[model samples]
Target chain A: MSTPALDATLAPAAGAADAATPGTARARTTAGLRGWAVRLGSLAVVVALWQWLTATDARVGLRFDRLPSPTEVAAEFGRQLGTGVYYLDLAQSMIRILTGFALAAVAGIALGVLVARSRWIGDLLLPPIEVVRPIPAIALVPIAILVFPTDEQGIVFITFAAAFFPIMVSTRHAVRALPTLWEDAVRTMGGGRAHVLWNVVLPGTLPGVFGGLSVGMGVAWICVISAEMISGEFGVGYRTWHAYTVVDYPAVLVGMASIGVLGWVTSASIELLGRRLTRWLPRGEGSAR
Target chain B: MSAPAAEAARVDAGLAIRLEGVSLGYGPHAVLDDLNLDIAPGEILVIVGPSGSGKSTVLRAIAGLLTPRAGRVLAEGVPVTGPSPDRAMVFQDDALLPWRTVRRNVELPLRIRGVPKRERRTAAESWIARVGLAGCEDRLPRELSGGMRQRVQLARSLAGTPRAVLMDEPFGALDAQTRGEMQRLLLDVLRDTLATVVFVTHDVDEALLLADRVVVLGRGGIGCVLSVPDPRTPDIDRAGLRARIIEEL
Candidate 1:
């Protein structure tokens, strides 16, 4: 919202220069391909480093020998992909993440708007949320188990607790940070309070909201996996812990890799959705990340 | 007469807006004090003043964006309690929604008024063309130049067919040439519509060029109100008017 005053002076000059430069399809495709190449290259380097370290049986001060080799982990990963149990665990974890994150999104945004728009709500609601928010999801494990009747509900509660704070805090700030002039503009155009909320506040806060959603998705994955490992019979985290207990080191690595991929995919989906929603905004350099 | 009928009759009257003894302040600091002004229908009233003279405050009050501490602001002969669609404002920053395209931004007023989609699109397109931004419909506000964004703001304010348009330093950020062109375009658009305009600017020359009546505002209220016999006609001494306005400021 704060397009600086200097930008007003400089943007026209830069925009005019861009207008002169022909944006050919070939050039655009080439740039996009280069972007993908860089991403893949970084991933490849990390994988190569992991493979080399495992092949060498690299020792870090005392105990790096316990890590499974890349080939061993890959073989276990392939074996897991062929089995029904691994697939079931994957599905269970994803369902928990999805349902919990969705619940958090709805409640966090609703409560955030209430607290932001009403001083009375802020006074009564914000203080309690603030106090509860600081207690980490891991710390709530005992309390969640005691409160919820089922283990599944307890894990879901932990996931929701993990994701809620980021979304709520971001939304409250986003709502508060809305430029007053946009509201005034809508009001002057004969828009009522409802119109202002629908057209101005909602849309104006979207970029910030999407930012929170992406962060919340990642946090949900983390907390859900942790909760599952601590108390669940199903899910990637529970299976990984079971594998470690049974001395199946490679299978543990496979579970860890699955969680990483799922978390990456969910966060990437959020970022893609955000881009689609805010396509009207100008994409500045270095903003792709 | 019934309440609705009486209200319609009042709107039909020649007087478009009136501010009487309007005083506003933030806590202890006073911005406007005892300001009184009347704007006739279809008249171009320009307010000029130095910084802190409350010119922008006057526009806000007239637009019903501000409630005066001591007095009343009337629109279409009715006391202004809050913002009404009959009034539109062009902010100094050209406050277009960043997430909306130029066409959608221009259509905002009509959309808010619940005008159907097809009609709103047609009206928005016409206003986009009117402001000489026809091809830039799908572009975001950030993609356009400062001058172009201001033109969009002008088109948007006029698109609503607002009875009274309030402008607050709308072109204060534009280059001199662009400002002149916008001023001409504004007058051209207003000539065909029955819109009452109240434009606030710090530029005295701009006020003189576009205003039917140039209001010189000081710390408290209007220090002087100078009428330009006709802005189109050059019968009045332009240099003298500029000098007088400069002296008043």
Candidate 2:
């Protein structure tokens, strides 16, 4: 039904060749494969350069004599996967992270709601927390060691400190940003303060709370690993530092890789849980991927 | 007109609302000054005016969602201090809980009243059906159209069978056709109920169509009170009255 002029206007621009083609399933698959190929190719090039640098002693002016080649690190990774000690270290790190993160989640949300909802509570509580919040978890090492009886508890405290602020700050903003009409509607329906909290405040603030949780999970991993490296006797972080001290460069790389994988998995899990809880929300255009 | 019109606005003992010398302001800015009005039980009183005329503020005062700087707002015989279950409000924006399904949102007032689960669910279902949302019970507010969401809000407000209903531009966002349909639907639904309604709108036609009496509010207080003669059939030239209201504004 289009006229010649309309057809001309509808035609794709000359430089937009990709846009001219329909975005069918096969096209999507090809695009996905291309993305993977590029990523794998970049990784392979890095590995080859690393292998070349350490294959012999004379490849470059800058020499890393203690650096382990990719092959040696891969071999050590396989051996570590076979050992019970490796599993124990991984489990220890997980236990500390989960325990600390759980404590932070509960306390953070409680404090956030209290501060946001009541002026008296905000005045009484916020000052000390604001002072404590700016200090980094790494900076708290000496004080934590002195306060806690064991290194394990000190590491857990560091992890908790890392996560607590993000969750608390985000939840406070979430509660404050709620539409007044929602509370008004509840109150006019004979709902008391408790009912308003249950029906309006809690559910309304969940998306922001989950955003905090995701960021907190990533930060928790960093704090726990750093704490373990400096003070702990048995964790992935401790194992990594111990390997470096003993000059087992391949083992150190293995430990680093383990920590990286663990952090990625935990952060992904938090995001997945957030998505499940907030299925009613329409996916924003910016969050398409 | 600056003085409180309390004596002239006095109503009988069975009046639904009485605003006596009510003055409201925000910081240094006054919104309503010495505003006096009254509504009898089972009447549809519409407050219509231009933007910034404090129409919605008056509704909020009656609903006890906002406190006035001076004077009293009495509902039945009780002086308004805070929101009560007997005075439900339909907000301009559909304030249905985004996480809750349509049925659950409508069931909220009953839940607050401590009605048992089975009874509240049944009551909510009946009201949803009355509002033409029976099949969409499980749909969240985000999934529904704006008109549909407004219907859910209306159903939620009426579910409690409140003694008074305060509405602030409840259908101001709907398309013209949908707005007309909703106005008709409101009348149909409230035909048998004896609830007093204080509906606020900028739409003169909507006021003439719905109100037993229309209170035209100016910058700070009442301009005039015009009776519709018969809301269902205005008998007078509706356009002429609309023009008169436009002039007053």
Candidate 3:
């Protein structure tokens, strides 16, 4: 009897209305617009500063006389965009990344789950993986060049190597870190080994696996570009290196800017995908209790 | 929002659980030794003990999650082996999977048993509503309050129509007021089924309120067993029983 009284007494105060009104909604929109303005404004300021320094050839502490101006880079960017070769390079680089990343995702997740699931497998496999993990994937360019017949394959291998360790390691940790309570709960309810794996281990590891994926994507980009620069006959990194050799300063600037955009876009996509996959996470359900 | 009146009460009289000279432990550390006990069908038996008294270990053995070092546990005259759907265990920590929505969590046991998808959904929603979570079918565990999460756990456990339910301080983590409500709600829910309950709690008051038989565990074994009178009777007094339980601790 007292239980109902306790709940009912608290219920009136607990039912806090959403409280959003016309005035607050307008305020929220204004705040959002202001936030975008600040972000875009910051980028515009940096571009304007760069343009001024290059156009005037300012040498406050370092010389900008040899660097390409914003207009020069923009014009070069437009010219490159019109050419079929530029698109080819873009496609080649993207294909290499996608192929390597896809292969790595499959293998890393499989091996990670395998090693984590069985103790003997972990003992046998983890030692060699840990040994190789610390060595930079870019540093493997020499071995890749020697072992692979084609530069394309070598670059892809490098990307795969760069991405594999992070994904594997994070997945392993995620699996091991899962709460035993879940497994026990399922088991008590007559769930078998497969059910435990499907219901608990895999879903529980998603957040950690995605965390590694985002990091692996970033690292793979780094190694792929370096591998291209070192050994590739084509691709964005190769083209950028070629521009440098030819002293096409504006083309080099265009390459650098394009790489920046590509990296940002890929990473942003990974994060968005990760967020969608783990939508059940509390997000910003604030406060500790 | 229909109450699953028929299926919810499907566990007719529950199973009789027996521990015959059972010795339970974890790898060289003995928690209970030569313990013998019998849990009556459809009875609420509460085990109260100080920390490390193996109250939970005993519950685990009956739930068939732990193997006794010596002797055996029998459920309905059959030797208990591995975990079975006939016995469901609820933990103090809300063990609802964080990734699963309320409906899916409630549907897990049914799904494991190969129950049809449509029927499982209907059963899950029925239990969800019966537990007073009518509109929270899609909410994740993390989105719910602690008390609400416990309610979901209760629904999830009972939805399976288990013969015996083992609860390990299921409301120990709640605030005082919420704990009281949960206790009330548990009694209300139990009225719908004849499942045997082995509730382990540190709170003596909780045991007195819920149990037909209160077993006090101490020194790695049963210290005493007290029978709680129906509190609804205006003339019966059990103050001495409460004091004995407190003194045994």
How many pairs of residues collide in each model?
Answer: 1, 0, 0
Chain A TM-scores for all candidates read 0.84, 0.86, 0.90
Per-residue lDDT of model 3, residues A219-244, tens digit only: 99998888888988889999999999
Per-residue lDDT of B89 in model 2: 93
Instruction: Please provide TM-scores, in order, for all candidate models, with all chains considered together.
Output: 0.89, 0.89, 0.89
DockQ of each candidate relative to the true complex: 0.72, 0.66, 0.73
Candidate 3 DockQ, CA atoms = 0.73
State the interface C-alpha RMSD of candidate 2. Answer: 0.9
Show model 1 residue runs off by greater than 4 Å. A1-60, A285-289, B1-15, B234-236
lDDT of 2 by residue, B1-249 (tens): 254566423321123799999998778787989988888887999999898999988988888888999999998868999998889999987588888999999999999999999999999999999989989999988889988999999999989878888999999999999999899889998885778889999999899999999999998589998888757664566887788888988
Docking quality band of candidate 2, CAPRI definitions: medium
Superposition error at A10 for model 1 (Å): 23
Query: What lDDT score belongs to each candidate, Candidate 1 first?
Result: 0.85, 0.87, 0.88
Model 1 TM-score (2 dp):
0.89
lDDT by residue (B1-249, candidate 1, tens digit) is 256977765553333788888898767777978888888887889999998888888888888887889989987779999887788899988599877889999999999888999999999999999989989999888888999999999899888877778899999998889888988888788777767889999998788878999999987679899998768554566888899989888
Q: Which candidate number maximizes DockQ?
A: 3
Q: Give chain B TM-scores in order.
A: 0.92, 0.92, 0.93
Off by over 4 Å in 3: A1-32, A285-289, B1-13, B229-236
